[model samples]
Target: MASSDLTRKPTIRDVAAVAGLSHGTVSRVINGGHWVSPEARAAVEEAIRTTGYTTNHAARSLATGRSGSLAFLLTESQQLLFSDPTFALLLRGATAALAERAMTLVLLIADSPGEQANVERYVRAGHVDGVLLVSSHASDSLLASLVAAQVPTVCSGIPRAGDTPVPSVSIDEVGSARMMTRYLMDRGHRRIALITGPNDTPGGRFRLVGFREELGDRFDPGLVEQGPYERDSGNAAMTRLLERAPDIDAVFAASDVMAVGAIDALRR
Candidate 1:
């Protein structure tokens, strides 16, 4: 080969030729190996390593009608999302999952109306194959717009009222809260206080309802405090609960950050 040819980037055809397989076989292996033989898969992988060939994602997307990209949409303000460890953990997990599937994740921060409009337009244009929405508030209109646009979407939590039915992955917030409250009550914590998330969110509303149901008649109005799911809010709510119900024996906070803040307040 000439020096110029030797330095050129390798392609799928080159990988197939090096692996002693058809281009179709190599393509199958690259696109998740649905019907390719084990021996063929091994050969293609070895050839890929030997040739240092990277997939031409744009070409593949053109052929397959898939962008191989997903969006992680955060509806909360950028400051709040960055301040919370939960968002960080979610982003890490989503990135790892998409990497395994040979896809990329696009982080979309749609905190303001203009940002939300731009994001909706991007999704409508099919920039990504799907979306993983998080931190959605009840008043958020983007969810409805995405649903109406027929863009594939999955939420990290249950959708609040007015959102169309979208697939989701979430814990049973109400059940878990009830379980926690029941455990405390069983342990003789009759004067239990509750720190709740914003009432507009499904998690916050359901958790508060669970706490009340578990506490029955013992659920005192004075012991209930509402706040954002942050350490400072937790601290403030705990402090207020303690002042109003000094005899309170235990507290149930809606989130881990809030729980830590409640502990801090207890310490002080």
Candidate 2:
């Protein structure tokens, strides 16, 4: 075959010509964007199969100025986010949403400042149409980089204060923590101890605040502790809490995995 013919990727126009329909009709069927007559749809489908026509995502993005994709920037310590149940549910919801929109999802992990800088470059270069920022630490510079890039971003949780205005979606951590703490209080669990992870983040800070709020003036600040959101950290925190307040009736850890650690410590 000639180089020109060999190099040509089968496109919607070729499919349309083969099916004796307009390019718009082929586009509609291929993209599932609009309705088409049954007969014409069937003919177009047949042509697509025969010619092995595939939609070129890059070309479509160029013409439409939309990459038809979103990026999820996971900037936390991988062990924390990957092992946490909360992030697992978050992944499921985000995946389902993108699938429904017929868009692609690109996961970007930045565990260090250097990796984060690379992610910033990609964003500035327009590698994706939008981004979903998650688990940004107080000291993380990625937030500022993202803000400077001017990317359309939605956060899974708020970045630390002074981090730019990125819209986010998260449960009311303070409210949930307050409720949990109140449950403990209602059960007559007075000498309560708490294990929190990275008091810098919303989850840890809010849960600790809620515990204090529920305890009122009787709450001892020393009964609260902070740790790594890891099983080891949880185990250590629980041990320390036990040493510091042996008569504790209940303990609340910031995360479920940490809670498991607290349970392990309780058994010991």
Candidate 3:
């Protein structure tokens, strides 16, 4: 074991020493194991494993003009990040995926105008190579601003605001909702109440559309209630739905958290 590995974090030089190769050779292997012999690559890999060496992102950023980090930006209140389990799922997933590449994920929340400005500044300052935008609103100007600044951004859901079309990773929100509605209907559920998320979000808007389309002529406008994708909002929506239409036999909330809230209201 290298003394540096025990005393402090091991550096590339330490790895080179352990592998009995020059620092440049170690650097080449770290970059991608290309232009080096198989023997050299194997030795460096073993040394890296033995030393438990990690890339110094700060040094790498200065050298390559890349931050070696990505911002997991949430376009909602800071508290919402903790209160909503969906955000937690996204964070864990992104963290694990980035860990494999030895990259960092910075969490940022921008619900208000001030926070939005700060987030925009931080991202534009080259603190991160790109952004994974989450929980964005329909009219959110952040996407437009990021796009205008030529910053790389990929939304977690299909964005509805920008005319420029930001890159996104999303499931078939409409199809999923339609299927859920159909499933409920197949069970002989009538007088169904729809507890929709914020109308501006893709899930909120698209899911509502799917629910309405699935219901078709059976849809009751009075049974629909809109709220933020939060438990309390869901509870309130469900309570209102129950009060307005006591005959309601089923409901489809836009998200799992909201669905949980609706369940709470039913229990009450």
Cα lDDT of model 3 overall?
0.88
For every candidate, C-alpha RMSD to the true structure in Å: 2.2, 3.2, 2.6
> Per-residue lDDT for 89-188 in model 3, tens only?
9999999999999788998989988899999999999999999999789778888899999999898998876447888999898899889999999999
Off-target runs (Cα >4 Å) in candidate 2 are 1-9, 28-50
Q: Each model's TM-score, in the order given?
A: 0.89, 0.87, 0.89
Q: What lDDT tens digits, residue by residue, belong to model 2 across residues 13-131?
A: 78988899998988888777667989998999999887888779887877777788888888777786667887778778888999998888888888788889888888778779999
Q: Where does model 1 exceed 4 Å of error?
A: none
Lowest lDDT sum, 10 consecutive residues, model 1, at 1-10
- Where is model 2 poorest over a 10-residue stretch in terms of lDDT? 1-10
Deviation in Å, model 3, residue 177 alpha carbon? 1.2
In candidate 3, how many Å is residue 266 off?
Answer: 1.9
TM-score of 1: 0.89
Error of 1 at 203 (Å): 1.0
lDDT: worst 10-residue window of model 3:
1-10
